[model samples]
Target: MRTFEVPTRDQVSPEAQAIFDNLKKQVGMVPNLYATIGQSANALSSFLAFQGAQAKGTFNAKEREAVYLAVSQINGCDYCQAAHTALGKMNGFTEEETISLRKGESDNARLDAIVKLAQDITENRGRASEETVEAFFAQGFDNAALIDLIALVADKTLANYVHNLTQIAIDFPVAQPIEEPALV
Candidate 1:
């Protein structure tokens, strides 16, 4: 199989180059995943907009990272697993806690609800069980929060599928392997 090389800034459209520059200025470097997405003329911008809009939602940084970790784990996206593990830690999740989140649980009941719902959504392809939806709301999430969760799942799903299809080189610290659950 051929490797998909991440395109350099100069190799992409000027609009993508600007996004790349902003990524470098903010994050210190263009991560391989972001650079790879920049290969599309507008995908990178759309992705950034979606990601940026998530912060305005009800979930905090920790909760959002939990969503990322849970979806990445369910999809078995090694690239995202590694990336979100580091991001999870930065957002106050311990390594052990991050692993637990990957397994669709958390010590905190509220967060566990979030992770469980995210896992269900991914595993069921958006047909999350009514109980799971109820549990999510019982954890203090409103309808708007649920919508944001779904949006986050959709955003992360795009990244998960991209990495799965491309088998992109992971730029984050290596995540330990876990057996992927069989798809239903």
Candidate 2:
């Protein structure tokens, strides 16, 4: 269970309420994870803002799911892994692909690099090594994508932290859970 009550739209600050309203319009409902974060308007708004900023990454939808799947798995955020697993499917990731990502493997070479980069960020706490970043670009990403990786990492870190703190219920179904942890 969550450590404290998750405020509804009316309970949060006006900014968070507006964000929540927009979220509902876009996604049909504000996710419970978002609801919990809404306890802090800054956090909820920051999460939403980072998501929009990260959309420019070199990682495509499939690639984003790959990175999210890998990082969520490593962070032991079952809720996030589950949510992303479902999204991965919606974004065209196969069951085997999702499995490979959680294992830190990737058939799509470009995404392999992104997944690895996300893992490195998770491990290094934004101080990723030069070699790791070099490998990411060498694999085909550009500087802009590299910059977006920070946003992706920030978004995932936020979600994973929420999951770790509260085993948030998934708003969607997911593939089989990744039992092996790949470290946040």
Candidate 3:
């Protein structure tokens, strides 16, 4: 089997090295997945810029984290699941709440709508169920919010696909595996 090693500051391009320095300064450590992305000449910088722009969209930090959790879970991206689980907690979700979001459910009605919509979008490949879309709007999300949510899905999916393809080591606390139901 092939192995993907996380690139170090010294091994990456100067632009990526500079980004690594900034990430180390800002996030304390450059995550393995992000460092892996740094192996590419432009992906690290482009991803950061995309993420930064998405951060300014309609969803708040917590809401965005919820979307990430749901999308990551649906996509079965363990790296993203672990990373977003930690990020969800940082944005104020309790451990249980994060797990629930990963399962595509939430106690809060509005949040439930958001998480469900994220999961639906991911599972259906952009063709979210009309019912889920209706519920999202019923929770007071406008068209702008819908557009932002789609963008968030796209953003998270990019990272998820990268981690899925590379199988990099996770730098965050590992997320617990969700159990599957036994056959009847």
Candidate 4:
């Protein structure tokens, strides 16, 4: 159960109504995350703003979903992990790839590094190591990519933690849990 009242579909603010409507039409449905966020116009607006900001990247939806799945897995957010796993499949990521992301080991060191660094930065409470930064750079990511990843992290963290706190119903089905990796 959510701590706050989730706006009834009819109760959504005009601004959030438009955003959620657009998302529903395009994505087939307003996600439960968005539904819960619809309770707060500012939070839903912030989520959309972050999405807009991250849209300039060279990373395709698959790569982005990989990052989301990896971080969600590490952070143990069932809502995000399940949601992104479905979206990742829509983006053409294989089940194996999704599972790999959940385990933070998709065979590409670059992505693994991104996932690890993102999780580490989040888990360490924002204390990222120099080596982590260098490793990210070595993976062909530039300063802009770093910034974009930070934006993604912030975006997902808000929704993930919200869902965790709320025990938000999974709008998507349960994805099989991937192995919780030994501390990397």
Candidate 5:
């Protein structure tokens, strides 16, 4: 397996260097995934634009983190699972709650809806069941939030796939194993 090189700021184009500078300021350092993305000058900036736009959407931090956790776990991306696990904690999820969310279950009704929807979409390859959609809305998510959810799915899917393909070093606290609940 060929390992993807995580480019340093000097190795990328000037445009990507600027983005790396901004990321360093924003996140304290450019994460390995983002650094790998800087290998494509245009892609890094475009991804930043898309990601920044989504941050302005209706989903709160916790909700957005749930989407990331569910999608990443379903995709089996270790990098993202680790990254979002840390982020999930910062967004107020307990370590146990983070593990539950990663497994597509949540004790909170609203969060369960979000996790199930995200998991269904990822597991089913972008086609969540109608029941999941209805439950998501019944849980008080509007059409805009639905759109945001889809956007988040797209975003996290891209990140998950990137890490899956690159097999990058995990940059955050390691996530625990995802325990599947026993089927009754």
Candidate 6:
């Protein structure tokens, strides 16, 4: 099995080093997963641009975090699960709510619809069921919101796949695993 190391500011290209400095300034510390991405000459910056562009979308911070949590959970990316759990809390989701979102359910009906659709889209490889799509629309999401949601899923999935492949150390508090309900 191959092992991947998280690159330091000194170990990466000048562009990635600048990104590391900016991330450190903004986030306090460079996350291990971001550091790993920094190993590439431009991946860190490209990812930052892609991630930053989400703010222009219809989903607010909380909704975006919800999608991220659900998608990360579905993708089994421990790193993103931890990261987004913290981010979700910052975006006003209680810890329990974050857990629920990760489980592809939520106490908020609209948020539940969002997570369910996100999970379905991820698990079904972008082919969400008509029922799920209707439920999402029923929750007041328009076609633009749907497009934004899909973009959010794709963005989150990129980090998920990177962390899954690299198995980097998580920088945030580790998220508790969701227990599966027993079969009746």
Per-model C-alpha lDDT, please? 0.89, 0.79, 0.89, 0.78, 0.88, 0.88
Task: Answer with 1 or 2, whichever has the higher lDDT.
Answer: 1
**Global CA lDDT computed for model 1:** 0.89
My TM-score estimates for the predictions, one after another, are 0.95, 0.86, 0.95, 0.88, 0.95, 0.95
Instruction: Using TM-score as the measure, name the better of candidate 2 and candidate 3.
Output: 3
The regions of model 4 sitting more than 4 angstroms off are 1-6
TM-score for candidate 1: 0.95
Off by over 4 Å in 1: 179-184
| Candidate 2 whole-model C-alpha lDDT, 0 to 1 | 0.79
Model 4 residue 183 lDDT? 40
- Looking at model 6, residue 162 earns an lDDT score of 96
Residue clash pairs of candidate 3: none
Single out the weakest 10-residue window by summed lDDT for candidate 3.
175-184
Off by over 4 Å in 2: 127-131
Tens digits of per-residue lDDT for model 6 on 1-184?
6988888788999988888898889979998988998998587788889888988888889889999999998899999989999999988889989888888887789988999999999999999999999999999889999999999999999999999998878889999888972110
How many residue pairs clash (N, CA or C atoms closer than 3 angstroms) in each of the candidate models, in the order given? 0, 0, 0, 0, 0, 0
Q: How accurate locally is residue 162 in candidate 3, as Cα lDDT from 0 to 100? A: 88
Residues 143-168, model 2: lDDT tens digits: 88887777777788789998688765
In angstroms, the error of model 5 at 156 is 0.4
Q: How close is candidate 2 to the true structure, as a TM-score?
A: 0.86
lDDT of candidate 5 over 1-184, digit per residue (tens): 8867777899999999999999999889999999988889898888889888999997888989988999898888889989999999999999999988988888999999988998888788878889999999999889998888889999999889889999878778889886674110
lDDT of 1 by residue, 1-184 (tens): 8778889889999999999999999999999899999998599999999899998898899999999988998888989999999999999889888888888888899998988998899899889999999998898889998889999999899999989988878999987665555222
Candidate 3 structure quality by residue, lDDT tens digits, 110-183: 99999898888888889988999999999888999999999999999999998998899898999878775111
